[model samples]
Target: MTMTMTKLPRDLVEEILSRVPVKSIRAVRSTCKNWNLITKYERFANKHIDKATASERDKEFLVIAGDYLFSLNLNETHSRKFDLSINHRGISIAREHSDRTVFIAQAFLSQGLLLCVWRNVIDNRSRLLVWNPYWGKNKWIECPMTYCLYEWFAFGYDKSSGRHKILRFSSNNGDRYMEIYDLSSDSWRTLDAASDINTIKYMESGLSLKGNTYWYAIDYEKEDFNISLSSVKEEKLAVLFSPRDRFVIDIWVTNKTDPDAVSWSYFFKVETTQHLSGFLFENFLIDEEKKVIVIFDIYGGANNAYTISGETGHFRKVDLRQSPYKRPYRLVGCYIPSSVQI
Candidate 1:
């Protein structure tokens, strides 16, 4: 007696389907009406995303190199790799700015949704984009004239309202005014957060944990800040600290993280190479189980990615020039897609 494919239990079917690549999920949905319906359920989508993200063999990250965006998977050899970019998401998102070459100037990940400021080559005009790559969906936001030079933007969600928001403020040298963009209303409003608020720049690590943004509060009492804060597994906050005077980098994680309360515990430390002196950018990802950390940085106009082992303290570096484009790499961290499309 032969068992038929249709005879497979629903649980088994879902388990198999969840492993399907997100880009190919649409095709899976098109296989049949029942399969299509299964993929549509909120539970199924979340399960698929979690399973795909958790698998070390299948895990991949989004990196923004010069003039292009690429996907990275550390489990594979350093040759050719899995790649998709803003241009591949389809034509409509960048339709208005067709004349200008599109490059992701800024990338911030919040609850898996990537908020990008796509910079155009024609005249350096900027466009705000919110993308849900898993579903192949995107939204282009209209910016108000109030947006200024040296402005930093963050993507976050309001748990109370169940709505997504963008925080915009001046950095470096500008006005004290803060503004926010609401996706529900498709409008911008003033946000009087702090006049003295100094935020992380585009080149710095911008960690969005549990659908919210976080930044280090300046300690007037302390002198040096040698740590970079990022999200580990998206369940906890991890900070990698490298003192200028030391050759070791330490990892710390906070189990309880919130705007009101956070306490960090030391994870471990690893020895670094002399080439690893630069600050870790917003584009690094940590593998907790493997005791490995893959980091990216652009220093002195050169692009390089490094991996440091917490278990053995071994160091290795990969040049971004190895990419097909041979362009400089401006590494942005992994892109985790949120269920919310906007």
Candidate 2:
């Protein structure tokens, strides 16, 4: 008599793979043809996302320090340098290049992946890279320069299409333009949405939550009463949509990704305590499970971090002196390290 191995059913295999860590799923797919097919299935992706979100874990913060990237604890007391190999333009490059080390300018987190806008240390040429830290893998996307003056970028994942997108806005000679890149197609297209908010012109990093992207902006012109009477009246109606008189930070959400029908909405606003005049809101991240919003602010030359209750509107500053590094860390995104291979 001889013993034989039995193969599990496809559905049973899928159920098991969906529950596994996202970073490990890529390897799981390689085990067999059936496993590979199941892992790439859309239903499997959705199930994996649900499992990943439902799991409870420590919140990790992504911070930029000089030419390196760091993942810090939410309490700001401990940090570990991320040592994954990073490459540009599909060419593997060593991070040890001190004279021409690459730096992340803008970054956003989607699911378990980190999307970054990086600049060359020598020539300052900008490019996009999507990195799966747990798996130590990244893919580079060439960024085409559309505007010569100023440019801003935002990253989001479109659940409907199962695609990642980068929104680029540039201004030249006071004229603003918008373009979008679809990772699936590996191409860029112009966005013709009629937007006059003037806030997207300067957004450095966008927050991607639940397949939607958001930017934090302050409507200063409307809040200032000393401006021209005609302009003040025009902005009065807009200000009413936001919180009154307080230090209001407007939340703008991306509504559509369709090039022909792209749009946005002023989703919500948060009013902070008074004396926020000199403070500049740099970046923010949301803890959906805990219902907490962490916003980073810059005052003078120091770091000002706050954790606010999403429901109560109460907030308090987070002390960062306990950390070893004294310099302000630019909080760009949130990172959840998993073994999910991309």
Candidate 3:
């Protein structure tokens, strides 16, 4: 049977489109001329984009509940969870590696790609996989052993060279390195830019903005924190120190401002509950429309989740225990590479 667009009001259609995830909107627009015209409107598209982006910010938290990786949507009323077992009957790199037990160290969604790290159970070797969850397709790329040991890794786009790069530190030897993987050429190259930094011992966390990757680093003694920004095209690294002893810091690059001119000062920092403790800065949420940063804090003692906003430096407690889903065997949050985004 053919569908009729005449029955639905324009406002109602727009509202329904706004509620749908950004990934699905394009297909919906192709359904008919009315949708194509409505969705093509600059204002309408901007409205939906803003709504989707805001939803992504609030829904940044990732939890392994039951056998699924649950990512809360901005509405909180709705959520999208992917099965962790890798038997979901989809065209995913995760499914291709189903034979091997997968352990996700970090995951993030950016530019229509989900970048993640998975370990092979048999060989105990680590590999970086890029998957399109929406399309169910994935490609696995081998990560050097030197860069695999570090807990934090970030993958981002390089505008100048139009390549994808991964930045990670080698904790075993105190070596900070970056590996640039060219999707067009299907090859990887390591750069020596970050190798000279001695004081920036461990790469704590990272953020990707405007074709560059920004990392949070700590001194070997853990006395001070620093930030390093790398150019994907030039393969150059520049280091900057934080204004204070930022126990935990997270960076977010806003699209509203100039990509290159945007400075690190706009980033937000969260002071841990205790000084120099083991609290990890797992993930962060950036609300561009509201110009605020929401940070997720996971402590070892209670495994509780907290949020710190740029508007208020105070850390607010968030209740995750009340989630209806079953929790993972253990709750551990670590730095995830930018490549993994569902």
Candidate 4:
């Protein structure tokens, strides 16, 4: 039977495409040339990302387990692994311990892409690579050999300039050197953020919220209160503290944007009655709308996320099935899906 079908207007078609899931949109692009062009359009891609990110249910997480990459909905149970061999060639060395294996030493996610650090166990040849698994694209970046011994990497985007930068920090003797890599120029420049090696010796978790980057240190430093509260900006930094003396968790927030500013003040504290013994609290996420803080628990082989109420101070542990940590290595990051091509 022959039937006549009407084509959707370009604007209306794009609006409909922006509402569809990112994974499904990729599949439907091959339906027609117009659909393919619309899906690849930068404006349409940004629109879809904005809409998808606004809803928590449509979000997807990128998981790095062992040498594999997995993608899954945080609200669901199952995860599907992706073939990340797009840039795996010439980056790995043959290491024969019993047989041979390569591990994903470190990984960071920023603006819908992942920056990975791969280290060869046999030698000290380490490589930095960026991957956009959704689009099946990956590229290798030259690693700075000056701080190859000990260095930390962070990925963040600047909203004001729409540029992405990678922060690398390393220590030599007692002096710390900070380097910033600009993705726009594809170059690296040394930053003049003076720091005592002792001050940055211990850091627990790092998160990139909005356009700023923050690091939660294990050793809490005392800061002045009145000066930090002087800011009128709506955005602020909030730190969760779990002291070694008690089973109480403290939340501190500050509005000052200066790196050297002492603006943190106590917001609230949670006292847990449960036997949180032997349980290591690694990271946390704040759900401001729900007034709850989600805590990551890495104890034994049990991987759990505990949500504690801000008002009542009650908490419940969420079972996420598999342990985020495998042996001595663990992966942690938010699952944010977008249609923006890397």
122: Cα error in model 1, Å: 8.5
lDDT per residue (tens digit) for residues 170-246 in model 3: 44465456666665566777766645434433333344444454444445555554333322112222232233454
Ranking by lDDT: 1, 4, 2, 3
Worst 10 residues of 4 by lDDT: 224-233
Question: lDDT by residue for model 2 over 175-232, one digit each (tens)?
Answer: 8788888876879898887555465425445556545565445466655521100001
Q: Residue-wise lDDT of candidate 1 within 169-203, one digit each (tens)?
A: 65434556677889888999986577445533334
The lDDT for every candidate, in the order shown, is 0.66, 0.55, 0.46, 0.56
Residue 267, candidate 2: C-alpha displacement in angstroms: 14
Task: For model 4, give the RMSD to the true fold.
Answer: 7.8
Clashes of each: 5, 6, 12, 1
Candidates' TM-scores?
Answer: 0.77, 0.56, 0.54, 0.70
The candidate scoring highest on lDDT is 1
Error of 4 at 156 (Å): 2.5
Task: Give the alpha carbon lDDT tens digit for every residue of 202-285 in model 4.
Answer: 333244545555554323366311111111112455566564556777776764555455466566778887655445544444
Which is the winner by TM-score between candidate 3 and candidate 4? 4
**Better-scoring candidate (TM-score), 2 or 3:** 2
Q: How close is candidate 4 to the true structure, as a TM-score?
A: 0.70
